[model samples]
Target: METDKRNLGGRPGITVQDVQRACEALRKQGRTIGPTNIRLELGRGSYSTIIRALRNLGLSASSKHKGGE
Candidate 1:
């Protein structure tokens, strides 16, 4: 029951730590941790790619990934 139109996982070639670091940098700049910001921060990757990575990392627009800070 699988289809090429549906992907079961996040797109490859991007790292969680890289997203995390980008999120951290965004936080420092008082920006939101959304796909567009992340993509701009990354200077590569599509929005979907960034979003999947964020979802995989349990991060969202209002994520507190850097908790206890």
Candidate 2:
């Protein structure tokens, strides 16, 4: 059965769900991963992507470095 052939261009690899799962795994280990780190782990370079995911999970992203400096 073949009819519509439309390619959604994207590199074949892990998905956002996979990224979320990985974040969960890190959380369980008491490890914190910022949006930047998440992007890196998911092989993505966009902070917006990571931030959106975290926000969806009710997690907040730091706007600056820790230590309140």
Error of 2 at 57 (Å): 0.9
Give the best candidate by lDDT. Answer: 1
Worst 10 residues of 2 by lDDT: 1-10
**Where does model 1 exceed 4 Å of error?**
1-12, 61-69
lDDT, candidate 2, 1-69, per-residue tens? 211121112444434455567576556655566776666656653566556555555567753223322
Alpha-carbon runs more than 4 Å astray in model 2 = 1-16, 28-30, 63-69
**Clash pairs (backbone) in predicted model 1:** none
TM-score of each: 0.65, 0.51
Q: Residue 12 lDDT in model 2?
A: 41
lDDT of 2: 0.53
Candidate 2, number of clashes:
0
Candidate 1: count of backbone clashes, pairs at least 3 residues apart or interchain: 0
